[model samples]
Target: MAEKTALISLNMGGPDRPESVAPFLRNLFSDRELIRLPGGAWLQRPFARLMARLRAPKARRAYEAIGGASPLRIWTECQTRAIGRLLGEEWRTAVIMRYWEPRAKEVLTHLRREGVKRAMVLSLYPHFTAATSGSSINDFCRHAVRFCPELDYRLIHDWFDWPPFLDALAHLVREALARFDGEQRHRVTLLFSAHALPEKLILEGDPYLDQVRTTMRGVLERLPEYRSRSRLAFQSRSGPVRWIGPSVTEALDTLVDEGVREVLVVPVSFVSDHVETLHEIDQGYRDYALRRGMTRFERVAAFNDDPGFIRAMASLVASRVPASWRDSRQNENGAPCQGTP
Candidate 1:
């Protein structure tokens, strides 16, 4: 273990075991930052438990469809380790998942034990959103104040346009397109699907939608060959509130009606394989599109520690990591704290 510094990657992790699904959902719904139920904060935990109990069966089926559990932690572990190697030996790394195990308290405890004086915090979410990235950062900060109050930390935010990241997207797009015959390739509609955010959040000034669009523009610019054929749509929408759209379903409908026969789906927002990519898009939407009149439907391979993406993380760290981090934790007296955790 490296004592100099630790690189911690944050993500919306999933249940990797069969029994964890319900508890995972409960943990997720409890985060008021992400989903706000009809009740006030007082009822958030109770509501979360109820929601999780009600939805767990469906969620479990989805997990079972994707090989019995979420592979997110595996992917995140691979990514963080690869990135740490690229950043050189002085830096140790860990994955601190939101709404799952290896939580902030766990990671911070390990870092403290390793005598890590500094930490470089990076979010797996490339797009900045209060619900996703913000929640993760806040969770880490809250835990740090108690478990590692003196630890120096710096946050690395959105890197959606990091050059190597765009390169990775273009490469995946080309790979997916290659599956089609030359003539059919020309006809394939590129459907870039991003996770949906609540419309209320966007209205309240979350830049996530705009950032997603900008990322699309970046990738399309790199692969101008598919620029005209590409379409952007949102996915994984749930709850009673309106979400950003047109949804993946609506987009497919228009494509099918427009006489588009082949579609190549891209999981634009996620950096790794999880339920969203493996189950939601692969099993759910793929079946939906085929049943609704699409001859062929396919999704691009997830990044999942792809060499280019790891390089992108390295580059982002090199460019953005501060020489020293500011300690966000406070003393027992509620004043500025000093030293490492």
Candidate 2:
């Protein structure tokens, strides 16, 4: 029998149905890594439930605006299969949602049962933060320690500036810019929007902001034509707490004030379509841009299963796997892995 390897991708999942919205929010808020309650650890669950109850209705409405459920799971499954096929028969890929179904514990148990000898945990988040990559890694590690300590496992923590990834983003940006009339392309303000993190996390030494900036710089360097016209802004802020800024709303306002009538929004941090990209960005931001007198507002689609993106992911995974494993599987029959590093 061949040695079975597991490639696990981590993401903050969304509810598959309307009824799951509240529970998903509860699970998210209940995570100490996500929200630090005022009272104590004991108060987390109750506060999370209260917050979820207060927020669920609004969240559900947002979800409803985009086909009544999130496309995250569907897209993630597609990515999983694509990567697995590239990795060949020796490796099995799976996606684990941080806040919903197919959680860490369940995935760990499943791999163990499948007799997987080695596992590589890959974060869907290109960038890292205590709230996201940190939390997911810690959660999986905890479960692995208790349930599958013997399994040989490793993590691909952050691949924000990977070459193939940047190439794919640059390609997408160029494609979106092409949508505008050639004469007006130079006037389009390319806004790179990343998910916002609370100021408190930065105060605690979280490197999310810095990493995001680094990613922005790297991407800009690759697309020198857009460097002067591009700007970075943060989005998806919730609660009253101060978050890294300028918020996407403020950025739009600034652009409107600057007499910029055309804008192209790029969700720099996200790889798959979810509530943030689907509704928050496409609908909410588009409306805000129009209301502010912008004549055009468009966003680049998330990479999803873009051929370049899958190749980048495969390259990242291959780079981390044992050399012996790579050498042994190099001749496996299947479509060749493209853009491999």
Number of the top candidate by lDDT? Answer: 1
Q: Candidate 2 lDDT (Cα, whole model)? A: 0.84
Clashes of each: 0, 0
Q: All models: lDDT?
A: 0.86, 0.84
Question: Which residue pairs in model 1 clash with each other?
Answer: none
Error of 1 at 281 (Å): 1.0
Candidate 2, residues 142-242, lDDT tens digits: the string is 88887777777667888888888888888888888889998789899889999999899999888888888888888788778888888889998865578
RMSD vs true structure, all candidates: 4.7, 5.0
* Deviation in Å, model 2, residue 8 alpha carbon: 0.4
